[model samples]
Target: MKPRILYLATADARGHLMRAQLLAHALIERGAEVEVLTTSDEGATFLGEFGIAAEVLSRHYAVQFDERQNMQRGATDGNVARYLFDPRHMLRDIWRLRRRIAAVDLLVNDSFHPALLVMGCLPGWRRKIVHVYGASLRRALLDNFQGRLPNWLARGFAAAISSELRRARACLQHDFAYAAPARVAPRLFNLPTPIALAQLPQQVQGPRAAVYLNPHFRDPQLATGLEQGLAAMGLQALLVGEGYAGRAGWTPRDPQWIDAAAHSALIVSAPGMAALSVAQVYRRPILLLVTDQPEQRSNAARAADLGLVHEVVCWSGDARLFAIQVQEALQRLRAVAIEEGADAGSQRARQRLDAWVDCLLELAAEPR
Candidate 1:
């Protein structure tokens, strides 16, 4: 008999939901009976399209932002507790899922507090809580506030978030691979931003670029920059996800996104996990127009530095200069990708998932 698996993800963005879906599908393919849960109707619909119906619940996110649109660290401990990690939602979700969740043999959590709490109920069952942590809490915070905020203050916030992450058996660092070597989160393993690219075509020849935009950080200036690039090059752009100003691609549907990535010559997107994960797996050359989002900013810079991408374009001057940069970036894209760390790391993520599932099944079969 297959082990029962419950996968929970906080659908703050389509990216989180996509990761959860990918992991759940992997488990299902490995003969685990898997059920998925998310926090939003849109996320549920996304799963339904994949033929895996999902249950919805209350979720948490960062609620503190500064005047400069940066995530705040000064009052994060309290603000996160009150706003981001609201006990009321946790209580409600716990009550709603009280009966069903505890029956699962293993719980995979990607920001799903209720699943974590429920799976941690039995004496030794806490070890079955698999936490999927996106971005390194300590590393991203440090990078975001290097000279702007005092070291101690930033460290304090990291400590606070790190403490919150301790309620896991194994925590996989998604995308950025800079989790602390020891402690902080339990058994931190560096995993790629889980993308389901096993069956997709490796590459295709096309003239246009595929662009994905994050709606939260949507700026007219950035849109104009993309527009200028397209107009100058006369290359049709395929836009993905919620926000984009260029030619229409597909909605954030899985099939259309994959098709766009497979066919595009160059990929353009915010350095968010969703697009980057796909780009990493597809081994496509990319240009990132990073938002002020600290994690996105850090990921974009790190990816560019690692040679995983062609360039990071932060709009400083005007659209035309940005256009010139984009045109240059497109020209630099190699038909075949240059060898990069993200290339090897994405494969490692799949291997780790297989190992994790084997371990989970073994433990589940052991006599108590």
Candidate 2:
């Protein structure tokens, strides 16, 4: 019988869901039965689209931010206790998952707190695989270095993670780094693969541009200016992904936006892995908008350095200048034949994804 695998993920952003969906697809393709446990409705819907079963485990409340983009004081206080120690809720949810857990041969956790806790409770189940993405690992390391807790407390946390690491069958690091020679069974790169050229929609041809607006950033002036500028350039711009909900008159045009990207000449967006992966699969040149997040900045820089994209437009200040730079980037991309250059990057990305699938298959075959 094929191994039954349970995937645990926290859907703080679309990137998490996207990664889970991709990995689940890879697992299913290799004859494993996969079920995803996520923390958001959006994630559930995304998984459903791929025919993967998903159960929602938690809902994250938004934290308000100030003009400087920093979290406002007292904004998170209201939710802290519930987020940290809601045992009743956690236990109830775990009970729901208990039967499913008993049926699965292996568990694959992708940085979900409750799932991590559950894994710790499973004493003899040493076949758990933990997938650590770049952002969560960086956060853990930074928290340790910042002296955020007392020395004893810090050591305790470190010991807990170290013990978990030893128990994990394998650790899949999903970022652009050379695989470590030791300390893990199979080290795999975490990057999306390109869709097969023959499988891509034939009509998805031409020069197109994409823009991802995150409404939570609270920069209406910036968003308005960007939309107007893209329209002025007569470039076919596609906007996908959701911003904050409940904002006055803010409805996402995701369907139309997705269609636009598939047929556009160049794609422009914030450095979101999901968006970038889609653009790459469609063979579009991406113009990335840099953000405050370090991982995004790193992805943008690496993309530029690798010639996988056209340019990175940093929105530090001067909205007018930023708009001008975006326009110029679009013009440059429009002049090139994106299809001709897509081969190199697409092939490398596909190989990496294939290797990840192979690693997962090997783990599934191991004696339990």
Candidate 3:
């Protein structure tokens, strides 16, 4: 019988699913049976669009956001605590997943901690287990210790999450030009951004900023001043998000992203792995929009520190002042060069994953 692999992907962000979809397809082509389990309605639907049918967990496991639309750790912990307090929800989740695992030969988790607790760590699981992470709780804790959260609290949470990561036989992190992770699990593979190569535009346009905003901070009111600021600077700004989805010269989605980037002088967006990948692919300059999320803020900061991005700004909700800042970003974009190597880095990561999966299959076929 062919080895079967089960993947539990959290619907926390669109990028996570994008990365998982690419990997899943690669594995299937390499001759393994794969099943995906998600806890997101949107993720399940998105997976279907790619011709991958995934089972949606009965319970809603979507990340809880604060009023600011940033992920709130307290709310997230409370959501997970329900399973501990209520035996029924816990048992139902376990039963459903266990039945799916009846013939599975390996477990692969894409940052889904609940599944690790429910299934991956179970005894006699019969195959190699792999854990994948796009972002790290430990990295967040270390980065935000002095700024966002108290040091003790950050340490506590980071330690807890880092401990849980050790459950898998191996861990793979999708990263790029990053500082060393705070606490890496044993047998961890700190790979580069797993972006697929694509054609980039040879001739580029000028004086336009491609705005790719995250859905979390897609509020029109918050962006109103920034929009006005861009207009004041005489630069054409095209907003790429749900609020501005599909209008003339505006693409409110990632599908239209490369085309939009081709028409832009620079890209303005929160720092997301996928957005950064888009910018990398198109070789566009980036102007970071600081948001409440630590991941985005840190990514923007780290990129700037590495000289990959031009400028990073926090919205002051003042159009006149912000316009001046936007001008500065424009100038910076023109003055610096975007570092080259993502294509080579991503290619190496793909080869590594393929080799690892092949090794696992070969081991499973060996006699005890």
Q: How high is each candidate's TM-score?
A: 0.74, 0.74, 0.77
Query: Which candidate number maximizes lDDT?
Result: 3
Which numbered prediction scores highest in TM-score against the true structure? 3
Ranking the candidates on TM-score from highest down gives: 3, 1, 2
- Give the Cα error of residue 103 in candidate 3, in Å: 2.2
Q: Write the residue-wise lDDT of candidate 1 on 1-368 in tens digits.
A: 77887788766556767667766777778788988888667678877877778987654433344322345566554544564356665555556665665687766777635335455543456666666656633366435445656998767765655554565565766663332222343356554455554433345444677776543434555566676776567677666654332424334454456556644666787677767666666567788775456677767767755557557777665767878887776666644555443435446556645654554455455543
Instruction: Provide the lowest-lDDT 10-residue window in model 1.
Output: 177-186
Segments in model 3 whose C-alpha atoms lie over 4 Å from true places: 1-3, 66-68, 126-128, 141-160, 178-186, 200-209, 229-238, 243-252, 256-264, 277-283, 317-324, 337-368
lDDT of each model, Cα atoms only?
0.60, 0.58, 0.62
What's model 3's overall lDDT?
Answer: 0.62
lDDT score at residue 10, model 2, on the 0-100 scale: 67
Better of 2 and 3 by TM-score: 3
Question: Weakest 10 consecutive residues, lDDT, candidate 3?
Answer: 178-187
TM-score of 1: 0.74
Name the runs in model 2 displaced over 4 angstroms: 60-81, 91-95, 117-122, 135-163, 176-198, 201-206, 212-219, 244-264, 275-284, 304-307, 316-322, 328-350
State which candidate, 1 or 3, has the greater TM-score: 3
Off by over 4 Å in 1: 59-79, 84-87, 112-125, 141-157, 176-186, 198-206, 244-254, 316-321, 334-368
